[model samples]
Target: MALDNWFQNWHPTFFQQPLHHDPIHNSTGKRLKNPTNLLPIYFSLNLLGSEHKNLKGPSKVDAHFPTEWKSKELPFHNFKDDLPGEEYDYSLPLRLSSQPNEHYSSPHVDSSTFEKSIYTKKHHNTDETYEDHHKLKALEITGPFKTWYRWKTLDFAYPSLLERSKAIAKGDFVVENNLPLGIEVYKDRIFMSMPKWKPGVPVTLAQLPRVPKEESPPLMPYPNWDWHSEKSCDLITSVFRMKTDICGRLWVLDSGKISITTEEAKQHCPPKLLIFDLETDELLDKYIFDNSFVKEDSLYSNIIVDLRQGDCHDAYAYMADVWRFGIVVFRLADHHAWRITDHLFYPDPLAASYQLHHLKFEWMDGIFGMALSPEGDFHEDRILYFHPMSSFREFYVKTSYLRSDGDHDDGDAFKIMGESRGPQGHASSSVMNQDGILFYNLVSRDSIGCWDSRKPYKRENLGVVARSRQTLVFPNDIRLDQDKKQSMWIITNRLPYYLIEGLDISRINFRVMSAYTDEAIKGTICDPNVHNKSTYLEPPIDEDCY
Candidate 1:
């Protein structure tokens, strides 16, 4: 992947300016490929620093606990480039990199506007095409973004949430690229996909005519991230579905889930598939499915999108629970929920700790880790889940019942991740690339385990790629990073409970916190003690999956 060699295949757009060797890697002995071949991988790597223009936080490397990147508030920061110990500011070199101040306003809309302009030209070639001309002309009334967020007080983490909270707080439409902590890409944009809530509850903001109106004020207003009315605001503002493809056209997968509960009547919520044409703010068609084949009263849960289009036609999509059981599949283009093509898996009753709990639902605390790999057929769609066994639910790390390879229900397929330690938060994460699959050890402090799904699909060790004694509450969101270390970033949401005082901090307040990753995690600290038994995170365990 030499730079000069990569230049051979890169498009002219990538070489618009004079290309020179990056001084950082000039003398490195290790062979490196050119940047052009690594566009997708690097795009995910440069999330925190040089990649995104606006980086807010002190340059000094403070102790990791509650670092600037961990805050669950609004995103804002001062301009900084290079690692604190290093002295290079990449902000100046990268075109899309926003100055710290730029984050306060909306990000660039050139991508979106350019897309629209191209469509206009295609529709109206003649100068006298009045209707087409008028259409593009009128959209100028309302520019791309209705509102932009630039964080001030907190570190870089809050901005991602603020985008969700701000969209809910404000009633107008918005275009966003804000995402989980440490993600550097500023181009994963989706136009208006959230349910706009005023004070509390889910409500769609259908205000139409994307173009600006003469008399009406544009709905894009800077709204506070704090929710005034607190009835499940997070769920309402949560992203329903996500889609990504190679070259921005090849399909990957579209996956999302919803949660809903109301008195006697209940239902599973699903994130709507929002297809985005990033260049233009226009939303493509949604992946709506027909649910007639599932139980008449069935509701949807968590999902996984594996969009691979090749001659093999082996591309697939997966749907399962957030913390526990249930996995189904169909083709990428299939929209019928009830018609899970060939596979459906549930927690096996005969497994070690996952002895059957004869309840309406499966497990409660075990939903954090869920990922699949095509490396081996035995575990192709084999789903994985972890939960804190509740007083009423069953506990299991890798439930065997969830895997359906013929009629084999031997209950020997699962691997136990913990004994009594409770896992909680958005910490449940699983991912797969060509190499292996990875997840944070829910019970171990800052420990992440990888199972080589390549040729052998067994839950064996590639050894611990990263570990630290630091008691990070939960390495909640695990991201792959081939650039730094094994290339992983763990996002932990820190919630402070008043355990010492009369106040009950157990109340569910989604505090914001996270952990940026690196090659070495040996020196990090761990939580001082185990969780209280009464915490809501404890999952009920049976004899099946331990």
Candidate 2:
């Protein structure tokens, strides 16, 4: 059956609703006449539907309503009053019809029926609001894995008991110390970064099956176990975050430090960037940052790669120095790097104090979150949006200034965009999708926030897509894949609690969740189709001098 015909036959009430009156443009800036038509195609090909039989990976699931669903239940927070505008209808499911031309008798179906038909379920205690029923929930892929691993038994399943005993005695693996930070998705494997913050982190960078049979699978060292040997300084020391570019290569930002959160911390090696070919699982290139660009207190936390016009050789990487308050720019063509510093890179003393999950702590982290605007024919200059972890404000600068070797002494080059995110607007990692929508982690509210780049960055424009106190305690990193679906991958480690008290091994402490970028922002203000009139905030002419 045709995809559109299936939707019309199965659920005619879906299209009977009011269509968006405002003009809507897609990622390519082409106006869409009826966005609802595009919905059926995505549903049939990528999402949960009877026609999604050919879909692969963890995403593939039987669309038929089961007697008892075994999938994890996602608790969604209610935010109907928070978003002001007409909400789009993206809650209906695409089910198979008994016969052609069949349609529902009523256009007004109980909202609960729509909610129950989908994969996610809301918290029982919360009242079912319009936002709660329509907001697309994040699906947990693989998570809450036992941090403490019996390496020989888990990885090999044949190593002698003596070998496992020796590993434990040598302090080679500590379960509580190994926390998953960054996450990236390739073709069939999901790569994660297990930074050496305390101790017992055997492999800093590891991979797992994207669709695992077991709920919590063991982490396998990427490439092979030999690449993570501690005897060699050339191997990965500690990796907090990484990025996979469009050229089929993984860009790893190794912090080169061990026991970072403890007094025994030491610099194991100079911070470096490692590029590995994902197809062959081989190291392509490794570049050590110049000492002049690094500092004694420097900590390389996150990385983002930019490829111009599909040119692999003519690429650039932007690395965030969280502790030193600067951005390190690397050119792939010449393998040269330079550092740019500004007062905006520094942390906000007031925002530094944080309270999450009833745990209080203070961390003065500088320049952490970084995202790039989508490149297009009309876009003359690609903008880079960034913000410090300890600040509620967002800032931006053009790539032209960053790529140049000239001095950036003039403060006008860096401009703060939009108003403050308020007291609870603190965010961790951020990424911009191909549709010009920026998705970020709201660490304080235990939610994921989104803002369309075409709209002004304000509280009214920013919308919360997903929120679950149990699942999104502290979303450490978020990345958008290059697939047609543009899936957004997130890793929540309950970071503040782990750093202050400790994580309860008995409970699920970590999670890897994902949602389709298009579906995630479908009905909220983040959707460019939703129209709202508001005054744009003017950029501050002068910045406060430190």
Candidate 3:
């Protein structure tokens, strides 16, 4: 079969029947269908979910692993002795009078040389590290943990754009332009977002084939992603998150702010929403956001597309402004927009600091992730689930309250659906599939967890589908493909490590991971096959953009 044809019909069962087994290796080596399962051959499995028996939990995290590099665990003391029934101050202040240590050493290394590399050491005892515990769980799953793609330093396909990237790297020794975030899978292609955190690098949005035609190559912006030209035709200032519609259009949110550093603030272009034809590779429309409500400090990072109206034009696009703490709603048909604000969008001071791998950092992010219930799932009303990255609680409000005929400023309309989960830490981005299962990245635990809206969001209902301290370090985005055979595509960039500890540019720093979405939710609360009828069914579209 042709590659594209095979990809569209690919299923997980093809791998279940292994071609050969090696006794020495004692492994189900490879699949008979394809050595690399990159094709889109999806299967619609009508499975009655596995009976709800208690499933085994992952092994305890190794106690011997190094928890911190330089700091020792301080002796525990009772702070209540001094301030009973009052808040004790935990913020320690540094003395500025002492001279600071200016000496530093480079920690970068080439991933190729393993013997002398920091990534590993030849220890005869195999039970020392976390990888030993993670390996058994991975083999029970599928595929080589071998990466899908990697880059020493991010570059572009075109020469002019490549040169610009090189020039920007020279000016600022530290840059995030190379880190890819907010991935959306559409058929045979994957669209990537390259935000302009540091200037000079070009192309805020790019796309490549799901299975690249060429051998594994460094990431490059697609369609000649050059810097913005005066034509304003194919220009994108900065983009963080995007969504694809049933109409084959890619909706991108260009934040428009390009400060030299995270502290500096400036707007290089007008904040706008751009829609592109994925098939034709042409710009269909650009809605420049010049509303009075979008403040200069606002950072528009995420977008959720709503098509419950049954047409692309009447659909609404909801965007989250994390920095300023507000939600912006855009009406596709009328091209009008408005902002909604509430205390729920603010971060909880208690859950602000978090630890990822070896780095500890404090963030003030608010309302970062938002997922919508499938249309007609809740008696014909859709509820949008959202939460702050600096808080553990999850909240939801009806689409009716958000989409009222002329109601945009109704803060009283917002509602909380569930109790606080409590300091589970940050989630980068999240999405709900047609089955009503919402998947979100767990930064604290270094795993992906899901919750079924139909059941109470307790520990029993919320289960970890996949976990890896290595592969899932900082999963920046979680996207469920809308194909018949569902698949979840997640991207992890180890952002905290790169920013705080500094990564060796010579090693692979970004990865794209995927698994069978249906199989993933099998024993969890979201498994819909167990039901006589689907939890939610997509309403037919009577209108198309084309």
Candidate 4:
């Protein structure tokens, strides 16, 4: 029979025959009732047609099917709207086999099917291959552990079980207030940062095993529980972000402020940078920022450690003062710190308004995102890429300029990289891998975007590596692991909802996700091997500009 006619007459029972194995079976050991379950078969047929245009028989296509079929549920239903008039009602009960078949292979199937499935089709207008590869299936490492922010053990404040019970009964441990903000992966542990935005936060810096023992594990105070003493000025107070250097150390940027979201917010101590030896769990260094380096409203939000040629002794830390619109440079060599400011560090009024997950709010945050290019001979000086949280444009300046004692504004030291990220391009924390690929969170869009520094910073050159409305909602931070694999770690906490409307503790409000950097950008435009030309057109100039 003709291939097109065979597809038109295709029935769901094709795979149910004695020869082919059916992958998705209902709990009752029957085929799924929903016809949408046959969508993958349709996609497979279309893919086969595109590859072999001269296909004239259905038997030829059947011969191409792999002997062992993988019991993986294809995510093709997500693109149901792409079909002309087929509107897939997700409300229908479509059951999948609880047990997946481990042995599965086909010449047509790619490695992506093992992680997340991406079906591609050629765009009619352009040579671009429209793919769902941008949608990454992020594995939740931990949390919405907000059911109870229980400590691994009771400390001096609540030395006895009775005291701990009394504290919990008195609303001291407000579970919802202990939202996780920062995440870092070390040897076998994933360090987390919980800023004391509201009351009842027990520990500001905590750690969890990389492999969870339970579905949700409780946060354990790093080093020990004593470091989180409420009255200790030498201990960590609040941390928004941290960086683990090539050396065996964790650079924590502690904000030293507590109850920030409440009216009773107070600066418990001067903002300080803490360096802890990861192996020994000992304090390596604690440098408190000078009053001159910090403003009254200065909010030190992010940190990145730059080492010259992998020398731990010759390292420097760059921190973003979001509220003050400046970069604080801490040189480990001299134990000295300086603040640098430029007009570009400030937030743009046009990008201040944000609408995320239907929550509308305005934040005039300044210079929140910071990324450093890989150290090499690519440029004279290592480039420091940064942008404001309330802005869509990315700006960069040389490390030589930021480290210098001279005035920050030297003609045009800071340059805008490329066109604006359009309107919904508001990004938060960002990180660069050794390959010079910059990955950042598109907070407004619920996606992670990538840009190869070698390519021009245009819209077409940028690619969304991972996008999920469910998991990536407000991806607050992105970090690349220092391991050989170079994995990308992200923490998504519905910050806007937590700040504006309270988070539903019953639902998974926060998530820690990870993906190998190399695998994440595999077939996307971000991949240097993918040679696609830019078709983006610049917006016409306004009449007033002329």
* Best by the lDDT measure: 2
For model 4 the local lDDT of residue 244 reads: 81
Of 1 and 3, which scores higher on lDDT? 3
lDDT digits (tens) for residues 211-310 of candidate 3: 4332234344543445343236347777788888877788888888664234554766677898887766678887888667567467788887877544
Candidates' C-alpha lDDT: 0.26, 0.61, 0.54, 0.60
- Candidate 2 residues 328-439, lDDT tens each? 9999898988998876676665576777757776666778888876665445456788888877777767788898878766545666554567675678888877666788
My TM-score estimates for the predictions, one after another, are 0.39, 0.72, 0.67, 0.71
* Residue-wise C-alpha lDDT for candidate 1, range 1-546, written one tens digit per residue: 122442243111101111131111111112122122111111000000100000111112221111122222322222233322323221111111111222222233321132223223233444443223444222111011011111111111123455557655673322222122221111222121121111122222111122222212212210113321224423223332222333232111122222222133323333334443434434444454444323323323334444332321333444433222233544434443323211012212211121111111222222223454322222323233332212111122222233223543333233332122222111234444323333343322333443322111111112233322222332334433222122333433221111111112232111111122321222111111111222112122322121
Ten-residue segment with the worst summed lDDT in candidate 3? 44-53
Tens digits of per-residue lDDT, candidate 4, 1-546, equal 112322232222111212132111111112112121111111000000000011111121112112432323322211111223323221111211112113322132221222111112212423221112222222231211111112222222234458557767876666667777787776556777888888888778877655433334455577666888668878888888778876779988898888876778778888999999887789999899998876766778788887765678988888887776678888998997788776667666567788775677777777888887665432435677888787777766777877776665463466655456766678888877777678888887776777755545555556666655666677777776654455677777887877777787767677766766777766555555553323122222221100
Better of 2 and 4 by lDDT: 2
Candidate scoring better on TM-score of 1 and 3: 3
Pairs of colliding residues, candidate 2: 174-200
What lDDT does candidate 1 reach at residue 239? Answer: 36
Best by TM-score: 2
Off by over 4 Å in 3: 1-147, 160-177, 213-216, 220-223, 226-234, 260-264, 408-412, 525-546
**Reference-based lDDT, residue 240, model 1:** 21
Candidates ranked, most accurate by TM-score first: 2, 4, 3, 1
| Sort by lDDT, top down from the best | 2, 4, 3, 1
Whole-model alpha-carbon lDDT for candidate 4: 0.60
